[model samples]
Target chain A: MQSTPPGLFRASWLVARKDLAIEFRTRTAFFSTLVFALLGLTIFFFAWDPTTVAAIDLAPGVLWAIFAFSGLLGLQRSFGVEQADRAMDALLAAPLDREAVYLGKAVANLLFVGGVQLVTIPALALFYNVPLAGIALPLAGVALLAAIGLVAVGTLFSSMAVNTRLAELLLPMLSLPFFLPIVVSASMTTARLLAGRPAAEAWPWLRILLAFDLVFGVACTLLFPFTVEE
Target chain B: MPQQPAGPVAASPDDPVVEAEALARQFGARRAVDGVSFVLRAGECLALFGPNGAGKTTLLRLLAGLLAPSSGHCRVAGLGIRDGKLARAHVGLVSHASMLYGALSARENVEFAAKLYGMPDPAGAARDALRSMRVLDRAEAPVRSLSRGLQQRVSIARAIVHSPHVLLCDEPYTGLDELGSAALTEALAERRDSGAALLLVTHNLGEGLALATQAAIMRRGSFVRHENRSGVDAGTYAMEYRELVTLDA
Candidate 1:
């Protein structure tokens, strides 16, 4: 005698909306991650001599490295929220597709990581004096692709790590390896695009990002149900 | 307090809402729930009483499809438990944990669940459930801000918002005060009257027996005594339960 449950995509959105609503109110993870990313950008700026490594050359690597680490902070808390009152059990018992749970969390993480990037990228550009006037659009496109890949894999590992005793340590340890390809591909593309190199030169790296997103996205969504319960 | 009907009750008493056949769950070498089986038809309530760590919670988890059984099978609302989407829509669960977002207001928490169940009017359902549980006054307050009893009330509201055909509750009386307990008792009676199948796990023998149509005393992963409530004397059930639990210990 119950109403039909929402469709998969709609259920996913509901989960996302719920997470976003909580995040909006608390803002603990989001704010902390953003601050850590901005702080990392600042430290990286002072660590290297501009004379030896040009800010433009150093900026892409620094940006992605900060993005990568900051992402772990957000991902670490993604499933951790559910552990508070065993809320994950409620979610697990729900009639929605498990994939919806994974996608919902992933979307929330993407936005969280992206929100940090939204603020941190401009901060990186400002601190390192990387010219953004000409390449803003392509750079953003690269960031979005890289984020999708990072979130897809990171969200999966986050779910796994959350159940462990050493979730904080486990998340970064398990995720960094998977994040390697994404960071490498993104930074390479960013470096080329920043150098005013032809867009054709970055095509291979972009393809790698695309391939990583496609392969891991589907694979992670499928594997998520296994990580949840017995 | 009888609630306004949340939804239409099952039309047939013979329709089984929950069924388990030889259900078993193991953790490493430990058999938490071993070869347990039961059937709960419409309007039936099964109150399970057991000592701590006797596998009562494990059995409930297996039935709810929260934990995959090591062996055997179960169905909820005539759908295989393995078919989660279809089975779970017909089920609701309340555990020791509130299973709520502490940051969200009470109303929002129930609304989230209603939306998940795809109720047509999530806000209205949440309102009615909260009102029924006597927590509507605190609907806008964050769950974390509420007292323990109030939190439990809100938890009940969330569980019943969809008017699930099967309700699985584990120690649902935890943190509730006397008034809260009475309210829960009434709610359970009303739900039973409305044809929802319930599996309640509790340590309170009196409270459990009062609402149970069928009762089971589980020990060491298996039921030592299970029978219809009418066949068991309420005065002696506590003594019997203690003896059974003591025998296992």
Candidate 2:
């Protein structure tokens, strides 16, 4: 048997790697999230009549909305592959710690959401003619924070939704409510950056995002065992 | 594997792997596992037999530190079930669901589990375990492509990969064929020989009787009879089990 404490980090990383490898092979969550994000952006571009609206004014909301919808798409499929094939029980039975399972799922979600964000960023810049060069670094930081918080809550709720009869329907319903705070902070921060405001002006929203990320991340880590058991 | 000679039993119950006292789990007003108490030593196999809805699964979950008891306490390796992190290190479970990731192959599933338990050489350990279970040929196959019996075998391999001190299995024989069952029986016997306590819940009387050193029958929410294998034959045990359920009804 292995020793404790340090062994836990190894275990968590292994779990995350396994999930990433599987997702990389099938592209199940990745494709769905990417396509959904593109669709969301296209609809908003056409519906808002971006030709009339100032590109800067619409840029922040458009970016935040694309991420939010893409995240929902990824979260919906996060456990879908597991449930379709009945692998969740095997995972629950393994000697691994329950928190590792949460982390593994979270990492998988992050990659899929991040991949969508990577593609959507340049697309949004082109569609709205917003200057992407100025705010790239701060925008990346905000996006990372928002993704962590969103995936943290989504992963927790997805585990619960996967077991229910109405898994597809229930996941969004349960997840969207918990996401309001994250969406607000991310949108506020992005909006400020888009307006060419200095980093100091957006620091408050950054703080809120950091706080949400820490709390939800820890809570999901602790509560995962109860959610995944048979 | 060499067997140990019979020796004098220890007098003190200083560190039982499993200890449940007046444990009961109630869903609303319905008592699922009621007033159950038992202590499992390190080198014993305790079979739990009951019909559907008799709370056998619930009791097994309680012992595995997977569920909270409504009225009593369940301890594994001297740690409370509600202790979360501490208790999980001491217990492992095998249920009907595969609980694996289908997108990944069988090898990846085991390695992932090994990582969760903080095991070194997770891939090597997982490979050896699958080979032992005769599922090595399918190790690289996605779990979705495997048959139910093969999947169950992978589930068993995953359960024992970390070598937990207490093994909790609920209907582990559900999907196994005869050969698969024999291989599983041998694997479990090996674990028992290594001082790991086995707590199993099953509806198959023949398999339960064959694998258990001691067996208990549950009716409604409580155990109605408990006996060692030497004390009762299979025919008499099954008859008594049926009678007990009938009487309760």
lDDT of 1 by residue, B61-125 (tens): 88778898999999887788886576787788899999999999999999999888888788988
Error of 2 at A205 (Å): 4.0
Provide TM-scores for the models.
0.97, 0.88
Residue A78 displacement (Å), model 1: 0.5
Candidate 1 local lDDT, A120-157, one digit each (tens): 88887789888886899999999999999999999999
Scored against the true structure, residue A128 in model 1 reaches a CA lDDT of 85
The most accurate candidate by lDDT is 1
Give the Cα error of residue A225 in candidate 1, in Å: 0.8
lDDT of 2 by residue, A91-180 (tens): 544445778778878987887788888999989988878887888998899989999999999999998998889987898899888888
The candidate that achieves the highest TM-score relative to the unseen native structure:
1
Model 2, retained fraction of real contacts? Answer: 0.39
